[model samples]
Target chain A: MHNLEAILAMGLVTLLCRATPFIFFMKRKPPAVLDFVQRYIPPMIMTILVLNSFKGLRFGLAPFGLPEIASALAVAALQLWRRNALISIVGGTGLYMLLIRVL
Target chain B: MHSNSEAPRVKVLGPAFTASIPVLLGYSTIGIAFGLLVVKAGLPWFLSPVMSIVIYAGAAQFMAIALLAAGTDIVQMAILTLVINARHMVYGLSLLDRFAVCRRWKGYLIYALTDETYGLLTTVSPPEGARSESFYAAVSALDESYWVAGSLVGAVIGGLVPTEYTKGLDFALTALFVVLLVEQIRSIRRIEPYAIATAATVLAFVLFGPANLLVIAILASIAGILAFRRRLP
Candidate 1:
């Protein structure tokens, strides 16, 4: 019951967050802040999300986040070269999986 | 007449499916990991799919495993979920223009806007003849199905697969983000947001630790953008 309650609460909270903008701005003109966020924040948030993915890395350790850095660079490079999302993701993830095992 | 009505819907489906392929890969892999983690954490296997269907947020669902294990209270869990998912509000803000035309599917679109779905929607343009709302709905529903299916598979076979083989499969999520970030960079064609976000993330990590990294970094980045708005292109 407790687990169920927690799940429901989390779900409600998440839906609320996702819905907040639509609820507020559905009928009115969104403020200038909306334009600012829409214009500049997508890339900013994406960059942060990409960086946050490395939160578990141990930078001070022996490998020193090398696998993550190398794999991310591979993904970015592949994406830049081929412009295919699947190829870049699969190639990068495959390389990371191999690197983690061997390194 | 029926074929005429159906033609553009068919056209939208193709591009929507193509755009969602990366998310299919990423969500399935990560969803499986979440299921495995849930079972490994000694929670009932059913909760994995339940959470996937209900919460539908990847990081928050993962965090819920730890929270449940620690016996965290419901209110606290809800609060943390809001904080963790706060970036989604920004996603909603960015999507206003795109979703403005989606009156019929607006509610479902809002509910299904996971990180990967949001990325795909923001980056991929609807085909010329198809309705944008229909395209958005297709991508969102397809992504959610992939997630639920993956989680169910993982839950059913939770203990069967050896942990070693699945070690870095979660990297697919990061790779997805990197691909999306590259797309964002390409379209935006500006360095300020990227630089500001990176700086803010580093600052947040160093100052507040990883526990509060995302929200703090997002707040700082928003502030940074506002401060430098005049100079930005």
Candidate 2:
């Protein structure tokens, strides 16, 4: 019910956002500064997004604790190890889950 | 338009495939986390990766989840997502000249103009006298494939994970970006963008909060870098 409606809304939003880039830039690439942006923005944004994810850092869904610290450490470690996106993700998630469940 | 027979598709294909291995591995895991998080948030099973594949924009997906979790309206969600992803306008314009020559591949290339793909293609000049169009096509397709494949993997993992266990996994995206930036820094001699970006990020975060920080940071960095470049020579 609520979930389904949200999904539909998300789906619609996703479609339009994803397609917007293609439509605007069709057969027309901008200059070098823009090119630099296409390269650099993601990494910068990712840093912010990741940090924000842990902003309210909590355990049992409320306040600062072990799980966030552990997951952050795991993500940093895995990222350094292979620089492989999938591995970093799985490794981080797996470690987070293990910590939450066992520790 | 160059006929299909003249395109050196394989030459471009090889590098695209080789380069994407790291991307595939990274994106799949990221996708998996996305899947687990969105599903954990109580979204439908089918929509998680569908958004990934269709939208194929990671940050936008995260925003979508946040907005959905709060029961925000469709129009608001849609507009916010658009504002967030509006940076692609810059990416598209940068590739205007290169794409102009790629007639047959243009339509599909336009469809797949993601951040990662644009990053790789814009930096690498095609081999002398080789088909630049083909190279662009190969890189574009390969990058999109990594994203699509990663999303599917995430969807699969989300389907299996329980909601209570989904915490802290979100940091994976952060770690992933750190790794990527470090990698980019290694190849780059240009430190101005890095410096400008760091400064802009700090400024934007303080001024605008995290919501519009990335866009503001990028715009500022671009201006700073351009000004600095004029002083270079």
Candidate 3:
């Protein structure tokens, strides 16, 4: 019940975030902040998220974060080259899975 | 007469399904990863499908696993979900005109407006003679079903596998973010946002540690962007 409550709360908040613009800005012109966020926040958030994904890595220890960095660069390079998200993700993740064990 | 009349329905349905193929691939894989993560984090497998069906936000659902593992309170969980999913607000803003055609299904369409679904809806047009609302609804429903089905599969697999075998599988999430980041970069073709985000992330990690890193970094990035707004272009 507790876990369900938490999940539902998150679901409600997510719905709120998604629906806010449709609810509030349907008729009136949206604020400048909305435009600013649309233009800037997306890329910023993406960068932050990619970096955040590395939060669990141990930089000072063995392998020295190489697996994470190498795998991420592989993901980026493959994405840039193929432009196919699925292939890039699978390839990068496969390499990471192999690398963490071998290295 | 029957085949002739059913022909038009096929025309609409076929193109919509084709358009959803890319999303079907992306969502299923990522959704599976999320499901494995939920079980790996010590939660019940059933919660995987529940989160996918209810929250339906990929990044937030992944974050929820971590939040639950940490035993975070409902209020904090809600706030984090809000921050992570704030981008959906912009998505809804851009979608208003397109979704206006969705009279009966507009509410459901808005609820299911994810990053991939938004991209497809905005870019891909319905085939000739098809209703736009029907096209949107089909794509939305198909994408969510793929996600839910994929998560269910992963959750079951997670329960069976030795935990060690799934060790580096979470890298799938990182790879997803990287792929998305590359796409974002291609579209924006700007440097300031990336630079500000990097700085904000470093500052947050050093000052606050990873505990509050994402929220603080996001706030700092917003401040940094606002301060340099005039010079951006």
Candidate 4:
């Protein structure tokens, strides 16, 4: 069985991530350094996460991880065209699901 | 005067609930998928709801199922959770002015700022005569309730399903993050952050393999950007 205490600890950590800025910034503005970080941190993080999702794909293997790469490109294209997050996500996930089944 | 105050509060919630419908749909399905993964990892079915109610970070909680099942230590799990949810802290940066008017409700708003909630909260304005405090709280609470309810339902569904049936459920996470990335890229026309993130991640992955590379990439990207901030937009 997974440790329930550990799960709760994870919960505490998440709450900390979500809450610390509010507590710290309540009385005063965030420092200039933080302001700079905030401006650039988000896009950087999102970009890394997108690449990180494709962490380990053996190029020589069958299916060759085509499903992940294809679906990601498709999702990006659909998002760029439709500009709707829900549509892009659902459509791309649907495509990925289909590809996994067929390939 | 109390009765007069309560009426707009009621009207306030109507739009907040309406605005949250999209999150309702997204969270319910994604939340169910998340709950199923937790159960698949051999936890008791009800633990899904508990985690959903408490941890509530979409990808972080999903990652937890794997890390916990693998018997990873608390410090690693803690750091992993922090790294995955780090972007959330900045969502509050944008909300400083929006949430400043709130008193009692601000705590709840801060606690519930998930990616979906933050996206919605930032785009929409409050309805006429509706206090921003109640409006924001209603959006946050409604989105959270969808997640909690979906987890309960997904847990029950997880109990009934065969393991193979949920095979592609994890793709939903990849799809969600990619969608967010695309949105971020589109919103900001600058190419520097994208270039920095790509270079840092590729360097880290090559140097350290897949294990804990994100933390390194994030740190590298942060320092990289700060040093070059003057030259780039």
Per-residue CA lDDT of model 3 for B1-233, tens digit only, reads: 66554565566667777666656656666677788888889999999999998999887898899888888899999988887787677567667667766688899998898866776675566888777887888889988998999899889884564547656766765676777788888888888999999999999999888875776887788889888877875
Pick by DockQ: which candidate is best? Answer: 1
Q: Write the per-residue lDDT of candidate 2 for residues A1-103, one digit (tens) a residue.
A: 6545554565555445444555666657555665655554444433433444544444465334676676667666775677664566567667666776776
CA lDDT, candidate 2, residue B206:
73
Q: Model 2 over residues B1-233: C-alpha lDDT tens digits?
A: 76765666656666667655545555655677777777777776566766765666777887777777888887776688667776665555556656768788876776566655655565556755568877778777766666666566556665665545545444444444544555555555566666676777677777887676656766776666666655432
What are the candidates' C-alpha RMSDs?
A: 1.8, 6.5, 4.9, 4.4
Higher-ranked by DockQ: 1 or 4:
1
Cα lDDT for residue B10, candidate 3? 60
Q: Is candidate 1 or candidate 3 better by TM-score?
A: 1
Which is the winner by lDDT between candidate 3 and candidate 4? 3
In model 3 chain B, which range of ten residues has the least summed lDDT? B3-12
What is the Å distance of residue B194 in model 1 from its true position?
0.9
What DockQ would you assign to candidate 1? Answer: 0.78
Interface RMSD of 4: 3.7
Task: State how far residue B11 of model 1 sits from its true place (Å).
Answer: 2.2
Candidate 4 residue A20 Cα shift, in angstroms, is: 2.0
lDDT of 1 by residue, B1-233 (tens): 66675777778878888888777777777778789889989999999999999999988999999999888999999999999998788889889888887788899999999877887788777889788888999999999999998888788895676768877877887898999899998899888899999999999999999996888998899999998878875
DockQ of model 4, rounded to 2 decimals? 0.54
What is each predicted model's overall lDDT from 0 to 1?
A: 0.88, 0.61, 0.80, 0.78
Candidates 2 and 3: which is better by lDDT?
3
Alpha-carbon shift of residue B92 in model 4 (angstroms): 4.2
Candidate 1 chain B: minimum summed lDDT over ten consecutive residues — where?
A: B1-10
After aligning candidate 1 to the native by TM-score, how far in Å is the CA of A15 from where it should be? 0.3
Residue-level lDDT for B84 in candidate 4: 77
Between prediction 2 and prediction 3, the one with superior TM-score is 3
